[model samples]
Target chain A: MSRLFRLYEKKRGGRRTGSKTVGSFGEALFFGIFFVVGCGTMAYMLVALAWPEWRANRQFEETTCVLVGKRVGSKETAEGEPVQFRPEFALKYEAAGRAREADGVYDVTNLYSSDEAGVKSVIEQFEVGKKYPCWYDPLDPQRVVLVRGYSLWLYVSLLIPLSFIVIGGGRMIYELAHWNASEERRSVLDSAAAVDWFEAEAGERHFPNVPDGSNQTNSPGTKLAYRLPISATFGWTLFAAMAACILWNALVAGFVVMVVRDIALGEPDWVMALTLLPFAAGGVWLIVYFSRQILVATGVGPTRLEISDHPLVPGMPYEVFLSQAGRLNMRSLEVWLACDERATYHQGTDTRTEIRRVYEYRCFVREDFEIPQGLPFESRCQVQVPEGAMHSFLAIYNEVSWKLIVRGHVKGRPKFEREFQIVVHPALAGQLVS
Target chain B: MMDPRLSLMLDEPQRTFRPGELLAGQFFLEGVRPEEIRAVEVSVLWHTEGKGDEDMAVHFFERIDPDLDDVVDLRQPRRLSTVLPNSPLSYHGQIVKIRWCVRVRAFFWHGKELAAEVPFQLGAVPRPQEAPV
Candidate 1:
């Protein structure tokens, strides 16, 4: 029995420990929140998208009538004579029930009459007939539309929300995968460390012993075995929610297009409401889903790199310590030096493309860097510090906080690291006189 | 000697308008105090810089009768506008103050065989119709 137990123990010990066991609970929770939020957001967007149409229609119904008018002159040029231009009509109409009267009546003229030729030529390319179509409410007859079935703004409005969903969804997925990998790695490291300490203690070797109560392993598997499944479920749920949002947005857009087409074709009012209802519902769903996700998944914090001091001197190098406070990790870090303020700093695929007129340097910190020998206090250090500090002791300062940009895996999980500032005082020039 | 002076000024020069609208302001005569003012003619002119050496000029002339009311006629004015040679109308609104303006492009020039181009501005305003009650 003893031999079998020892063999079993040996086999278990040989097995790689500290392999990260992703707590599905966190992931599941994250995804659940994400899914709900994404769907809610999508639904909200759908509603928002439909709002303008609804509002406009409501206003149309409330208002008495629309004004209608047309340009009267012939746009075409005559054979031999110069184009006989007809001046535009200027008419004034006042709103009823307003106490104050309008100041004065005037005739408006087009200053760029010469550019009419250019405008006409451009319009001709679109195969638009010479007859400019217009509309006004039948009841009021004063409100008007200059060109019928012509709306270029709709395309832009539709594209904005669609773009947001696509980009946001893609980012969320990438984050999930990255987060899973990181968690796995962390678990593996923790388990390995625990096993190593256990073996060292059993051997009773003189190698410095782990301090009492200070040797606790940071392992999710040991702490919460059920977390993985929960996390996975949550993650999948969130993904589904996000997908739903995108789908809802698409549906709303399609509905809007259809409604607009119907209106242009002079469709019945009954058909308009029936066609628009589904879009409105989808929009409402998106809002609910997004709001829920945002509320529940608010725990995801930011990545912060804290530096102990500023204005690192020429002779002294500061020690930079790195750790994580939130639910994420920084996978890469870098440091750079540049004298010009406009120097571009690129990390991975991201580019800082702006003209900054001042002293600047770019440092990439995926993890952290600690210089045992302090950084030298010199002019190079001045590149990172303000001009006032240039004359004082050397300081290493960051212009912007460490951005919580997740390269891969888990969204909204906060990761934090800190760096210490080491100031090197200037060397004395001569002996002191007391 | 009469100093061969030329000047221009507009009463209430700035005003706003809606689409298909017309603006009217009065031109004033200042620093003239001349012995005998013969004929005051105001020419509505459009000026732009010409390529290289030649300065381009296009103008329409209106004889301002000081005795007559400053009423602007949009459709038909007194005469076909003409551009003057050699002098090219020495009064740009920049220097002289001897002319008065009226509705759109009516100006007052008072001198013998003398012609002056007066500056006038016309603008178009867009009219968006409001929903009826």
Candidate 2:
């Protein structure tokens, strides 16, 4: 069982020290339990509810039976519960060259009603000593029913347990496939190998570790070879904020409606009402916050950055064009060439990522910058990659990246920073410095 | 009889090489019967290590099935080689490190498997220290 699904595997580096940690086995177990229970209950419900309907309609023998007597029968369902009534009849039929007498129920569902009048109305459809068509179990002539069909309520109720099965089974399979498997194992399964079958080809002068820069280099620039793509645009941020605000308020509105309905019934739920106050306040704050973001995004207009070359190398100089369009007064505007190191780690079950700026060089700085409504601010800055700067590195859990940032402080408005990502290739051997 | 053992050896004693340099290695099995071998897999790869999940990329890979090849011998040493790429030099950082290794795994017909690895350095990049904030 451990081989099939590992609850704990030997930690990679910790193997030498003989340490262990909880593995995907724990996750698989959790989902596996849900899968088993859901399937069991669903199977039981299907066999109990659907099997009889199917048998009555498709497999049971249809025959004519004389209703000797019909009456509205009542039975106590449970303690303190009202009595339930159903239409029943004494059935007489001939099957397999033999006469049989049986008590006939109205339907396979055995549905009962609290009102005796409803049951009497159903029995009125048939008269005593009249022949009526009914279905009898072929294997047992004594088992019979007056009606045969599916119950919509029972079938619809299956969806609840079905959802659990889908979620649990799907996640269980995924966890089993990825549990403790290394990246190479995954790549192998994906058939990502490109080298020669026997060995790596000679003189293959490619930097496989360097990230591709085609995303930034695809668009042609008016004055340069490539236009660097912004990491995050103000418009996208504003849209995300607006979406969050709408979704949050929509959820809060549902709870408020529930509370208001309870109050209208004169049985107000004070605990629920008190719990909704903080959520209602949060929705109001989100609305206000999103409104301010909208104003700033509209006032900021757009920012564009273009670079002369891509896949930059250390000890190289490049030209960058910066443009800002808006009607705004700025205290200062600065462009910085920066490199950041990022690492992601797991703490218990929580995953977190931390980033730190490892290198930064001032490219251009201007004071008392202003932009008129019709006139846009445009400038070019000469940026140099630091000689000893580490090239951009990317792995599953760590990364080193370079970027160009534009910081603008608008008078009487919040300062905004726009970032443009760039890739840096490994420096030449001679350029390396200690 | 001694337990089955797998040994891996790098051509370079120091196991250090520059980017775009050739990396060669070999592996041998001992205390294992030849008929018990099912297949062998060899790879030169780099993987990340530290506080986070490890990521790996294979530079070269090959598999040999002794049952399919009439001339293949599981008892003899097998050679493997590859040319390293010019980026992602072996790094020893505060939170993350990249390590290069030549790994050989052998599958036995009895449902047992053995693995051996020899670590090597890809570049001479100095260990990095966090810059003062």
Candidate 3:
């Protein structure tokens, strides 16, 4: 016994549970279907493999026989597309001291060919006037076939169903010896859940072992606060965007350079124009896209959020400061404080995170300015936090997040939006004051 | 007939509490052998249970591993104490449910274990302005 199966058997005891054919309902259903069909096919092939000899030896007599005549004919295949040629033959044989003859082969389902050439060649080998070993049933000596030997083709045909048997039987056996029944597992901690599984790095780092009866909580700022007008998630994404632009520009530019050099060398093909067309178009698009992105990032000089206090108190009016620099015809410039509740759950094969806007405090900068191209703008606003609102929280699958949302529109430019992660603690006496 | 089960009770019966308050509880045993028991553990835990899979955090743990050779009163109730955490509290949200509970687990030899949970509310409970100072 393998180590895994031995361990399972020891746990399961010698007594079996559930179905005898399978471990689970689905597996049992599968076994019932595949096992029956696979066993049936395999049995047929095995009988077909041994049937020629089995039939020759049982209730049959052997005698001298001659291939009296033979003919070749074409017939449609099962699919009706390909045509196959079958060989019909007449055999003369003697059994019970009586002369007898039979036409065609008995119970023959094997002789098939996609091309006529193969069956034609077999007919030439089995000449019309040739004597060959044959067999006749003692009860019906007239029922005779001139050829009675095992076929190599039947041996090869067994591989089809044999594969099914190996796979289905193996699944049934493995399912019967099923392991991994423990509800708690070592892999559960890998999900970065809020568990005391010393297995997670963050869990280990945040919650540590101190002597029992200690009143000290985790040291202040052990976890770096998520600063907002922009989230850390956006920084990596912008970096990746820039990196992709550079990589693509370099590749297309190199190809263009190579093509230009080849043309200058007087060996250019006109078909190169077709290949270079997409590269040129992509080159133009990248230039435009990157320019807009860079202008939004650097030209805006980082959207800043100034909260009146570190942990904003519920029902408290907190001052918020916002600023941005750009040349724009402002359709809308607004700063919004928002709280979103997110739930992460698995649906089928996908792990989905659904976010719902639970609260919002939108404040628009009332000042209008017409500074053109490369200038600065700043504003201040206050929004009241609703009392009894859920505080910012983060658990394994659930999160209540507070963020600063910034939106602006520059004239003839794309609308810009950015979000910054911030913390909002539940109103405690001393916690609201930073 | 002596019972083999262990029951749990809170020291203070208030269902709601401010974060960082002391959450204290106790576990009473009826008919369990202290010497035969491997360990009795009490933990301050918060877990999510719902459409989202459950996630647990053990904020505090107190364990009693009694010497099997020594004689002790199995009826002596085990006391448990821990400070509540600040961030995650008792929350019932759509698709996710967060619950804070004190759990007591008793372990015996040969793959035998029993656990009981007593849930409590923690986090920001809105107090009326004129309630108190």
Candidate 4:
């Protein structure tokens, strides 16, 4: 177990997690077994089906056989299971200048079925004492077959082991490639995402980790160069709540049906009815929660933010246009420029993520505002990315991001917050104030 | 047997550099015969450390194989140079720290390996402190 943990740690980029030893060992053991079973099954299939099929087609010699007898042969598959039937024919053929008699097989892979009638239909194909073309093993004349074709089951059975091999072998190779790899080496090996791209035409480095601002830039703003997209629209949250409510109530309905049926039969299961009380209450709570989400979704309106220029750099001033649409009285509406650093790490068997706000600046704030229907509250503000601040950074398990947050406290409604993501680039040496 | 000695040297004495500046270095191998050397890889890269899983990117990389480049002696100092990238300049954060380094790795006979790296500061970005709630 210790050895497996050591191997797993190396494969995990050498990050030592002593607390997660047991979990890592279990994962390692599962993959190890999966790989071994895959290889073993593949070897078994090669010997049982593939090799014999190849020999039957290549090494067996064609001969003529006279069918002397036919019968529905039944063999017990296992204890407590029904017997399976296969058609068998007594064949007499001449091989190696000698007459030999043997039982003829159907194909390279034998077919067995629980339906005896199906086996009888196959046996009825040929008449007794009739000479039919057959193939005989050159090495063993006793082994003869009337049919020498591949079975459909042969291909179907191979898919099972092949699936195992693909999954197991692919995982093993991935782990081995990452073994003892440095951070840079592993990053290069992560072929799913390219690390970075250097622009030869403009002599600039494009960091792949930074979120692309093309979507925000493509839509030209009415007052600014670009309109920033809102992160996480409320419609999705409402939809998710509705889905959960439906699923939970549907499950509770099943239990209700069972309890009602028991009561109708005059055998009320009090224990079962008592056990379902909490779940029934949970279903009711979900419906109420979903209804509240719907109300919230309908009440809140669209919020828009436009920036004068995209791909903002530190220490530079830029113009921002904000628009809020709704028929409501707001106590306060504020827009904040914020940067957060997020980190993810494994703790025992669980993964925990932490985010810290490293910097925040209030770009715009309005107190005690009102907006009537068909009219939106609009304002413009000037904001600057702080100097010596970290630009937007992203890695597999860490991220530093910048965003504009709009917070509103409306009278007689729940407080709301909306975020618009933004990208910040590193300031050039000349741009950084001393 | 004792392991072979590997060393890396950078041209900048203080090991501090700004973005878009030329970062030049070289590596040397000692106490091992040249015939026993298989290959040498020198790279200039930056990687993240601290609480999260490390992430890295290679600004430049070069591999010197004794068999492929026949005339080269393994012990001779080989030059490594590249213009550093502009972004991701060596940040030291609370839960995550981005670091830049030049690494030299040597593969010897019998599947033995040795590596050395020299750390450097990039872009003079001050350490960030978390904003109070």
lDDT to native, each model: 0.33, 0.79, 0.63, 0.80
Enumerate the candidates' DockQ scores in order. 0.00, 0.37, 0.12, 0.38
For model 4 chain A, the run of ten residues with the poorest summed lDDT: A194-203
Scoring only the A-chain of each prediction against the true A-chain gives TM-scores of: 0.19, 0.62, 0.42, 0.74
Error of 2 at B128 (Å): 6.2
lDDT of 3 by residue, A389-416 (tens): 5566666666767777887766567767
Show how many residue pairs clash in every candidate, following the order shown.
101, 0, 0, 0
How does model 2 score on DockQ? 0.37
Question: Which tens-of-lDDT digit does each residue in A327-396 have in candidate 2?
Answer: 8888888899887778887655789998867667789888897899988898999987766456778876
lDDT of 3 by residue, B1-133 (tens): 5757888988778867777788777787677766657666677767666555446666776566666435545468767777766656576654456777877777776446777888888864432232121
lDDT of 4 by residue, B44-109 (tens): 888788777667777777778888897677678888899888868788888878889999888887
Report the Cα RMSD per candidate.
37.8, 8.2, 17.3, 5.8
How displaced is residue A405 in candidate 1, in Å? Answer: 10
Model 4 docking grade: acceptable
Compared with the true structure, the alpha-carbon lDDT of candidate 2 equals: 0.79
TM-score of 2: 0.67
True contacts kept of 2: 0.35
Ranking by DockQ: 4, 2, 3, 1
Model 4 over residues A1-434: C-alpha lDDT tens digits? 66444433432543554424354345556766787898899898888878888888889999898889988887877789989988888888899899998863666666577998888888899899898999888887778888776666777888888877788777766666665554455655673343335533232436545666666788889989999988875667778889999999999999999999999999999999999999999999999888767655678678899999989888888999999998978899999999888988776678888988777889889999798898999999997887777888877888998999988888877778888889988888677655
- How high a TM-score does candidate 1 get? 0.17
Model 1: per-residue lDDT, tens digit, A191-255?
A: 34446654556333221111221111121222221111111334565677778887888878776
Docking quality level of the chain pair in candidate 2: acceptable
